[model samples]
Target: MLELACISKTFNPGTVNEKKALSGVALRLEKGDFVTIVGSNGAGKSTLFNAIAGAFYVDEGAIRLAGEDITFKPEYKRSREIGRLFQDPMRGTAPHMTIEENLALAYLRTAKNQNAFFSRTSKAEKQFFRDRLALLDMGLEDRMKQPVGLLSGGQRQALTLLMATLVPPKLLLLDEHTAALDPSTAEKVLGLTREIVAEHHITTMMVTHNMKNALELGNRTLMMDSGRVVLDIGGEERKGLTVEDLLKRFKAGAGRELDNDRILPSE
Candidate 1:
């Protein structure tokens, strides 16, 4: 449901600090497809997401979502069709907002209610938020009145995931969302991610620093190096893939041994 055509981006152009972040990077995702990405530092994984999210304009090429060209759309405008989660749990939610209040904002994405989100919610809407929070199984439904800052990192990220996908955008972008969580919590969040994405049939692209997560979580896996996608694998070829196998492919595509320095170990 998403396509990137020969996209490129460069920062600090024409100076010694000039660096190419994305080079003719082209990618496509089918409806309900979940693709995982892995790469070393400065591999353009996050840059690719930023480009799709409209954090900045691409230097060249085009981006289309569900057949609509949104290359020049501003971030707020594009947000109507895209949901994003960042590595930092604190980035998605307003720390001072209560759980239900945060969810109310997310619900507003698909909500036609012109009233301010902070205004009293209807009984049905409050119930809906409660039900959604209950799915996290974190007792957050009962703590809807508590500020988000009171939640643990894992709980906040779980809440963030719910907020991001609450309305099911045309595309979901997760950028190392679980990287900061503890092992058990990370696994829990990953499981929740899969369940939510599947239930909504949301097409997703997740950039992960965990090698095994890249191979294990999604239907397809992509490897990048020096701002380019060097390896892409999926379908039958990806069913039984392992980290060692991916390392081999990375070496072949990147012309060097895979760098494990930045990759998180499997839990």
Candidate 2:
């Protein structure tokens, strides 16, 4: 559903601080594929995401969604086809808006009307929103009138996840969406992620620093280093791999020891 061809990005080019963030990085994801990415800081994981999300233009190469070439599309234009969740729980939702209001906004994205106002929301629409919120099993449906700012981090992120997939965009981008939550909450959110993705069959790319999660969560795992994808594993191969196995692959792919202690095994 998504493809990146020979994508390369460099920051502060032609200067002393010129840093190559991506170098000829090519990747492809089929429909319904879930990919988890792992890399140390500066390994170009975020850069790859930003390139696809149009945070910045790549120094070279192309980005395509489905069969459309969106290499030069503005971020807002691309957003219509993409749902993104940031590490910050507050980034995707309006804190002052009630839960129903926020959901109405997301629901409108896939509606023919193209404009949404909670004040004018039909009874059936409100019911739909309520049903969607109920799926989270967080009792949010009971509190649809509550302002989102009143929610805890886990609640907000879960709500954000629902909003992102309210209409099922062509691709879902999750950048450590559970990184900020406590372990128990993180596990809940991740479990929710797996359920939602499987139910909706959403094509997804998740960038996570947790090696264990990277292997355990997605259909495919990508290990990146020095601005390039060094190891890509999937299917049965990925299922049989462990954190220690991935570490060994990283050493072989990058020709260096895996030194980042941040890539830890899950408890």
RMSD of 1: 1.4
Off by over 4 Å in 1: 111-120
Off by over 4 Å in 2: 111-119
TM-score of 2: 0.96
- Global lDDT of each candidate: 0.91, 0.90
Q: Estimated TM-score per prediction?
A: 0.96, 0.96
Across 64-146, the per-residue lDDT of candidate 2 in tens digits comes to: 99999999999987887899899999989999999999998877765655454557879998999999999999999999999
Q: Write the per-residue lDDT of candidate 1 for residues 1-267, one digit (tens) a residue.
A: 999999999999999999999999989889989999999999999999999999999999999999999999999888878999999988999999899889888878665556656456688989999999899999999999999999999999999999998888999999999988888999999999999999999999999988888888879999999999999999999988778888888999999976768786454
Clashes of each: 0, 0
In candidate 2, which residue pairs clash? none
